[model samples]
Target chain A: MDENPATAPLPANGPLDGDPGLQPERTALAWGRTLLTLIAASAMSLRWLPDQGPFVLAMFGLTIAAGSGIYLTQRRRYRRSVEGIRAGRLAPDAAAVFWTAGACVALGAVGVWLVLS
Target chain B: MTVPSTSTPPPGSVPRRSRFAEKILPGGTEPDPRFTLANERTFLAWIRTSLALLAGGIAVEAFTTDVFPEPVRRGLSVLLLLLGMLLSAGSAIRWLRVESSLRSNRPLPLPLIGPLLAAGCAVAAAVVIAVVVLG
Candidate 1:
């Protein structure tokens, strides 16, 4: 909640009372946690990585790339979020969200295949 | 998968009413940012579950399956992995749906996948038990 009595028009400012558009910050943190989980899962799955030659290795590379992309974009996302917050028109980060989910789906598919084998 | 961050609505930019935005967002108005953030958190929560399921699936095969008969073990692992895949995809779709609702000032959509997940797991558990008992 915004403790700033000086700020005008509370409801217009953000969703919650007194919150000065903290959505971006919160979303960025969520992104951080998501990326961390992905990386941890990826690392944990390493031991389980199938030795099916190049295909499995490719999976490993793709997973790492997803992690890297998330990592590299962290700051940029936060920056854009802040900008959006101030602009009073936050554009959605549909791409990043979808990408992260897609990566997990791919990993899950691979995991399923691994199990079936 | 990336939402194009290219649209910069200038402060107090004329509220442009378009069929596209109207179709995506529910209330016909831009939602408070907090709701958007909440939607994002929900999406991440789903993704976390997916990741957990994926890890669990692999761990089942890699570590826990030694005692299980080959087919039983493989079946369980596959089930978990499939669940993960479903969760991951479902979460993404739900995220988009909620975001649109928030944009339109519509009531947030309750997740449809929760019950499906519960039922899916129950069915899988039933299979697991039957495989062990009947085999």
Candidate 2:
């Protein structure tokens, strides 16, 4: 009962009570930039439509889907980050990062195949 | 307000860590949020680099139809696309390694991307130069 209220923990549901670094906001923006890049790549894939046929179209669709997924989840991630900081705990999004990496590798391999054939 | 807090936590209180976090990054005290965010940004930057490289590959294939011979064109395109693939995979692995290191309080691992990308780009340049000179 003698604990200093000033040094006590903030309420769990309190508004973003810590992290002045704006790290979460910056991270969210970084993800947004990544989504933008993916969309640009999708658009670029369309340039190969006439020659590469439907394969490039499929790639474009996939890229768009991935981009959309990122856009949709960004808000949740941002909120979680804010809460995480306040709670003094945060988990990295490993699955998303790995999946994105996997998609890039697949796209690269497909690109190689398309060019060779 | 977004004031930075270096405030000491009350004794006997445990930070609320998630089970998933424990599974992925099992130990060590949580590092500063700033560092984690920075690491995430670095990973995203690498992903962008991969996409840019893939775009370059596709551009070469799509636009260089008449400028270079078929064999050279295909080879160069393949090289670039492969580089993109390598970098994407490398970046993902690097992110995990770094995150784990951060969690464990170990020194971060050295990135092999700089050397690898440099060598690959040099080779690509050499190939292009040879084609331009000989063709």
Candidate 3:
């Protein structure tokens, strides 16, 4: 409690419990893995560029944008999670889960179109 | 029933969170942060599974152009893609249900997605194997 809330530095290894390296770290890494999988799916869409022309590029763009949104906010999320844990009020982020689902649906639609057309 | 708290809060009070959050957050007593975090990880795992399915669909379509007949390949690819879409959407619902259950101290819901995914993948594999054996 002595450390100023605003000025307290983030943990070097990432925000984790005093017990050291557990739940929060695992969750953070899960997000990271999800981001990587999304990027891989996005890149795979590029293989359709020649076959589907520019339409497939849109899928790539949308998928990458979604991935970027998650990537950029990761640090903020980690910080909030640590603070929420300490305060005993971890707010569940339904929007993040929903938007990720939406992005996957979009990607799947695009893939189906590419395959069928 | 109690009246909503409409009176203005004192200065420096934490503002109310979004309506979306209010709906989900107000119902359950606060669960352990670690449990909440674990739930988040499970949701992320499902997302990854969806992405993996999408990647498989793309790879099948992109690389198997000559291996399987056009109609057969397209059918398999579309099947996988649709499953990917289904899983991604379902996982979000699953996450919410689990969170709510945790809050209310109910037993966690059975993951209906598991059987659906297994069946979908099995069908896709069977189609591939049939094509390989027949043609």
Tens-digit lDDT string for candidate 1 (B24-55): 44364455445656777889988998898787
Q: What is the descending TM-score order?
A: 3, 2, 1
Cα TM-score of candidate 2: 0.84
lDDT of 3 by residue, B38-84 (tens): 88899999989988999999898888878989888888888999999
User: Which candidate tops TM-score?
Assistant: 3
Candidate 1: regions farther than 4 A off: A1-22, B1-28, B123-135
Interface RMSD of every candidate? 8.6, 4.2, 8.1
What is the DockQ score of candidate 3, to 2 decimals?
Answer: 0.42
lDDT at position A60, candidate 3 = 81
**Best candidate according to DockQ:** 2
**Any idea how many clashes model 2 has?**
0
Candidate 2 residue-wise lDDT, B17-108, digit = tens: 45665676777766665677778899999999988888888888888888999888888888889998999999988987888888778999
What ranking emerges by lDDT with the best candidate at the front?
2, 3, 1
Error of 1 at A9 (Å): 22
lDDT of 3 by residue, A14-94 (tens): 444442445556777788899899989879878777767689877788878998998898888777666555544566877
Q: Once superposed on the true structure, which residue ranges of model 3 sit more than 4 Å away at CA? A: A1-16, A19-21, B1-17, B24-26
